[model samples]
Target chain A: MSVPTIKFYVREGLLPPGELTSPNQASYGETHVQRLRLIRALLDVGGLSVAGIRGVIEAIDDPRRPLHTVLGEAADQVVPRYERGDGSGIAEARKRVAELIEARGWRTYEGSPAAESLATALAALEEVGHGRFAEILDAYADAAERVARVDLEYVAHQVAREELVESVVVGTVIGDAVFAALRRLAHVDASDRVFGETP
Target chain B: MSVPTIKFYVREGLLPPGELTSPNQASYGETHVQRLRLIRALLDVGGLSVAGIRGVIEAIDDPRRPLHTVLGEAADQVVPRYERGDGSGIAEARKRVAELIEARGWRTYEGSPAAESLATALAALEEVGHGRFAEILDAYADAAERVARVDLEYVAHQVAREELVESVVVGTVIGDAVFAALRRLAHVDASDRVFGETP
Candidate 1:
């Protein structure tokens, strides 16, 4: 049966209640229960309304379009940071960032959030005094440029216009999530390193 | 006033109403409202109840206690990838991770949530594939290592141990907020790139 039909059965409580097994009782097996729960989760927690959930369920059931393809498209909506060829000269970009920060009405100083974050991570060194921060930032800048260059080169070579656009959008969204999650993981690892030493 | 006290006032409607001059107002000046909101977010969204939020707030506010120190302590809660030290020894970790995936009843070959996340990343290279969803795990490991190394190398060399912890924690947390805000600046870059004449 179609997802809508299944959803209708669930909504009207026509479907057998989950886990009701006895000598005389109606019950859905694990797969049915799982499908119903998954549908519910997609509707409730995943923030898809009934129709969207049905569409998703339909997509999952249809093998012609892989679940991975659908999910990749879905994941693209929330996080995209990896796509390349988005351009801004370093100086112009820095100036624009400074403006954005100022527009937020935050205090501005050499050590201000404005200068520190807007100015390509030079401030990380400033905390330990200028010399050290500068050295590290220099090293980082070189590595970063290489990464960007390589990223651009790869994009140019591998992707066509349509695929590039999709990758750009999806990559940008997922990439941010990836980075944020990674950063959180980093903090967790640091804690583990400091405390966990049972080798 | 203490955070709890501030929250109590806000909840009780004891605080003066904020000026609606700006679109964003929470019945107090930005700082008070922000402090209250931060406390609330920590308590509510962060899964820390009032008491837990209070502890974190106290740690942040107490001049005697450093923020970075607390972060180092908190960071310990993150799970670690326990493979042989070399990246090459990822096989055992892979097996362990596969077991974890199976235990969770997650499908590895299809577009399961986990696969959607880590599959493309795993497919990037053989080493990456070994651990299945190891890309994220490794990205996190790298970010963790970089941040920790930066934290330790820079922080340890400067400041007393007590001061170092506070500064590092504050710096890390604040740096995160700043970095995120700054990264938004990249959108301008992105727009310029997309709209700019083809290079």
Candidate 2:
């Protein structure tokens, strides 16, 4: 980004500019520059507004707290509470899903969406069969929730507040990207597993 | 999303409407409808465009693939290869980060931004001497990568083809949203941890 853009960020309290050397020329150290660039990427590439970016930047700059604390806060911003099935055949589905969550050892709330999605899937599955969909999907949802917790813990270990936020945003998107890429790689692995130059 | 929007999607080949029941009427099954809604959320709310969204949807629709493939590709896209500092003080920082990633047992390519970010952070630590910024972040990255792998495995277990694509889209955005929300909850937990509850 341009120095003027950096200057604007400084003026907006989005960044802290380093000491000025002269009337017009000012020196920027690495953190200042790095923070500036990161903020720009989060704001521009990531499409966050200044205020949202500011909140993230401030969290990153703050040192008194542990990084996980900030990451947990960021995670909360994104996860929605899933509730399942209205009075429509969804009620039975919801119960089965709740059972699945319970079986997985997750504490499902009154109106969690994972539970709800499960319920919806259940209702839909009823059309297919009682035995097939219920047990398997519940297991998957439980696993998904567990994985999410692990993802958070991983965030705690790896990133400061700013990077944590960036990672969650980028990771979630890139996770899908990587998932697709790896799936292709897996095929290559499979093909190699089968016929092509097996080691 | 509105029916017209669904029509627009059908026309765009992003979603295919279900069987036509009469001359002017068509019936969309729950799955088709749900898929369309998920697509709308990703494209509109998540800010993914037609082509970007299409890549994701196509990735999901490919049941023969796993999510790790897609996520790996996405990571490569967003976190591009970055040049390490050339004889600059920043280079020292980069070297340290590379070492740290290696120490953490992560596979660090020489020119990746993730590697560079770690390097830059290490350089900062050299000057700052490890308070808020330190070597622990490398550990966190390692953990984050593991968590991502786990998430991909979970997705792999449950979905493929159109469902895979839909799950990827919803799961990707929702994972971010869920964590962000959880992060908020953690803040509340932090607040409770720090400041006692009101009488």
Candidate 3:
């Protein structure tokens, strides 16, 4: 990164400034480099705005925030939020989301942002005349549980809480992009075998 | 849906106009109602721009495009595209993507947008100091394959080709959101169980 870009991150409070070596010059340490990399990943890969990046960065810097709180904030920044419309479809979708948690025997908060995100997607599927698509919910939930278990198990070995938090935040955000991309590739592969064609 | 909303979809070429009955009134049918629902779902749920919806509507109207092409286009519109920067990070990322396809024995297109999307995501993970995250990718791929098989099986039973296309398009777009939400929920559950805490 250029000096100007580094200074810009400093101005935005996205990166802490290096130690002052002289009146007008500072020496950046390894931590600054790490922070810059994180800022880039959150912006470029996670597609988070500067404000969203700031929110998660704050959470990361604060040790008092519980693991769940950090994870939720990280998810909030990554997942799309809505100014939800008051429609019957949404109401039905919300009910289905609640039932999914119950049916799966998950202890996740029924009203979490993730739950609302699921509801919005469900409502959209219903509106699109693909209401039957919900039949595959259990299948998707099953797959998701497996992946999430892999995720937690991977992070469990990190000795520092800071590393664990960083792992959770980065994993939650970029992990979504990773899984979505893999799912699309899997679709292409499956469709080819089933339909006897190639892309 | 209101008259003006329907009129807007027609104006945007997202919905076929109703059959003309008189100069001031056109008789709407079941198709119009269904199209309106699709428009609503695409706009509100899929978060597609009007132009994106127009593109998909045109594809849905044209049977000349094969299933793979239409599916690619649908996936293209849903996945976030990038003005990729020429950096060593991205170059390495692309190499890993090709390796993943080869290792998995997938016959999918190497340069498909979905593949590029995955590459971008992996690159981002590398950038954020979690290159090790890719180690768990096979686990994710395994889960994705299961879900994709379920998806193909569900859509295969659709008798009509148009219905199949519709199912694939809606499933690809909304399914990502659904899977993402479920993954977060699963994380919440797994973290609670492993850490002995509640959100």
Candidate maximizing DockQ: 3
Please report the TM-score between candidate 2 and the true structure: 0.49
Question: Which ten residues in a row are the worst by lDDT in model 1 chain A?
Answer: A77-86
List clashing residue pairs in candidate 3: none
Which runs in model 3 stand beyond 4 Å of their true positions?
A1-13, A17-28, B1-11, B18-29
Q: After best superposition, candidate 3 residue B175: deviation in angstroms?
A: 0.3
Instruction: Fill in the DockQ of model 1.
Output: 0.12
Candidate scoring better on lDDT of 2 and 3: 3
List model 1 lDDT by residue over A1-199, tens digit each.
4656775856754343445478665466766754554443333223334555444444444445532243333332222221211231334435544654455432222323224343433222232222243333332223223322332333334233443432332232333333333444344345435433421
Off by over 4 Å in 2: A3-38, A41-47, A54-199, B17-27, B40-50, B63-134, B138-153, B156-173, B191-199
**Residues forming the 10-long window of minimal summed lDDT in candidate 1 chain B:** B75-84
Question: What i-RMS does each candidate reach, in Å?
Answer: 11.7, 9.4, 1.6
Report the TM-score of candidate 3, chain A only.
0.93
Docking class of 1: incorrect
Model 1, B78-162: lDDT tens digits are: 1111211233433443454455445433223233222322222222222321222232344333443465456455545555554
Leading candidate by lDDT: 3
lDDT of 2 by residue, B1-199 (tens): 5677777877776786679899888887877865665554454334456656566655656666654455433333332223323343567665665565456444434555345544443443333322233423433343344434444444455443454434434444433333332223323333333332331
Model 1, runs deviating above 4 Å: A1-160, A188-199, B1-5, B8-55, B58-69, B72-144, B157-168, B177-199
lDDT for model 1 = 0.38
